[model samples]
Target: MLENSNNTVLSEVDTFTNHYPRSSIKRITRYTTLEELHSLANKPLLSIGWLIICQDTAIKNSYLKFLEGLDQSNLVLFRITSEQKCSELLSALKADKVQYRIINNYKLKEEKVIDYVCKNLSITKVDAKYLCTRSGYYLPEVVKNVQTLKVLPKITKPIIRKYTEDRRSIAVYDLVNYLIGIGGKTTYEDCMQLVYEYRYGFEHLLKTTLAQITVYIKIYNLILDGELTLANCKIKKKDLQDKEISNLHDFRLYKIVESFDKISYDYLILLQLKLQQISPKFYSGVFDFVALLKINAKPGVEARVSTKINTKISSKVKEDLKTSEKRLDEFNRKRYTMTTDDCQKAFEYLKEQRDK
Candidate 1:
């Protein structure tokens, strides 16, 4: 996705706005402190989704009856981890309503899941005990996904994938990193080149609209209003080619970091001009400045809530969500933006819980 070479010739732009590839240390350093980023994984650490599949008619019907037996306030949260779930699961039973709930990792324990599965699945205690001890430690969803593998395909290779999460936080951290790069007087070509190189990871972000790019725009408006200190940060190797940095994991990230606050404003004017020259694709969300930011802020793991008829959701979900807001006199449902599909799934989950 590199632009035709006519415009990206780094020399055409002044040194303030343009930058060449820097040491992996310098690039990774510009991101939030090093303890947070990662190698590629399809799941965004910030989401709480679920994966539920019951191939056995008895298990499926039992789980559905279980859903029909719940109380509304005891709703479950599912972080649907797989964006590509259609091909992976339920291809044979495509018409079956897919159920999900968002869950937090702090609350999901292996022992608890094993206990729940043992009591619910009517399987031999030995098999239940065996599954409870499976060794894949990537995410709790890995366990849930494993349950479906008898019918679903096991991943034999590493695949690049994307999904959406925590828009505001992502925007803030990413914008700061971008601002730091520009303030450092890095060339625009290098910045654009980085996004092009790691386009797969950012494919979803690039499709998000700018209005969704909230925190950064609010800060950008504030910068114009002369409120917060705007600073530039830098590091890149001018000679590295597209072919050289193809393997991102090799981008040695074990370097030091300076917090966003520490970067200086020495190159502000140059940086301002640099922002002016950025293409509209970034504005339209066709490109994401975040490819350079490198990691999701606020990492979260997915919890797969099985939505079969007899499957019972543990009371754990309500215990977390139903709390009195200290400022509010009464406990109120927390408002969250969810797609219609997610809302309907939630509505069904609530109906199951509430109708009984």
Candidate 2:
């Protein structure tokens, strides 16, 4: 009787399992849409889905109109504006269903907008990715923003290593000088390659080395800071002349001195040659210390050295040392035998002359 009852229970279980809905067991493919966005606003404590609309004026107007046509009881359109009047206008038009915000101009400047979105919105990465993919105008910037947000700091170490392993620091500095010499224009890929080639060819420096990576990071940071700019290859190549080319050496020396203070002049010169050996593109320019000095002259001797070393002035600071032997030529031609008093008087005269 126990076995019969067990069999009965098993049959009932099987019958129930057979009747279970197959559709319910199937995977549901969910997608985001305007309807789902509306439903998100209906909860007692609603969390709004922030849509960053970066479209042309006409498209923006059309979107505003579409939102106005909807049952916007739960939806609030947030319009970001630059002009104070535009914000007021937008607020007046969609008084009940929309909100207006004025974002600081600086906040929209390169990569800052991403920080803004991450800070202001309560959203998932998937949702952020989706919004970035759908937006037309600021899409790339937004994607970059999200990437910057999600990227782990430790991951940057590998890139730094690759930079150093490639001897890219030398290449990057060379490229910067080349760009400056050629009037600050070049294709992005060409500039990227200028550094990348160094990394690929040099095996002594590994991408894993901290020292090597640090150099690359320093070079890139200079570029980002507008201390260096990249230009198109065709333009730079066309602008290249013997005179402009010769100045490249002096410019490089100046940059090194600027970056690393009072480095042995011999070491600085040797590094220039080593860089040239590693990359022939470096040899295209000449070094003009005198010209550099004229361009970067300061008010006094101490100030001059201070400014040159500190400010990265591309010139020689020790011109007096260079021309020290010629100092006697500045004296008057007549020689007179003199006592200590005469010598003191002459010294005072000479001091005044030198000051002039």
For model 1, where is the 10-residue window of minimal lDDT? 159-168
Whole-model lDDT for model 1 versus the true structure?
0.29
Where does model 2 exceed 4 Å of error? 1-54, 60-66, 74-161, 164-297, 300-356
Tens digits of per-residue lDDT, candidate 1, 132-231, equal 4432222343344344433423222121011111011123223434434322333333333334433454444333323223323433333334443322
Q: Give TM per candidate.
A: 0.21, 0.20
Which candidate should be chosen as best, given TM-score against the real structure? 1
Identify the runs in model 1 with alpha carbons over 4 angstroms from their true place. 1-144, 148-203, 207-214, 217-356
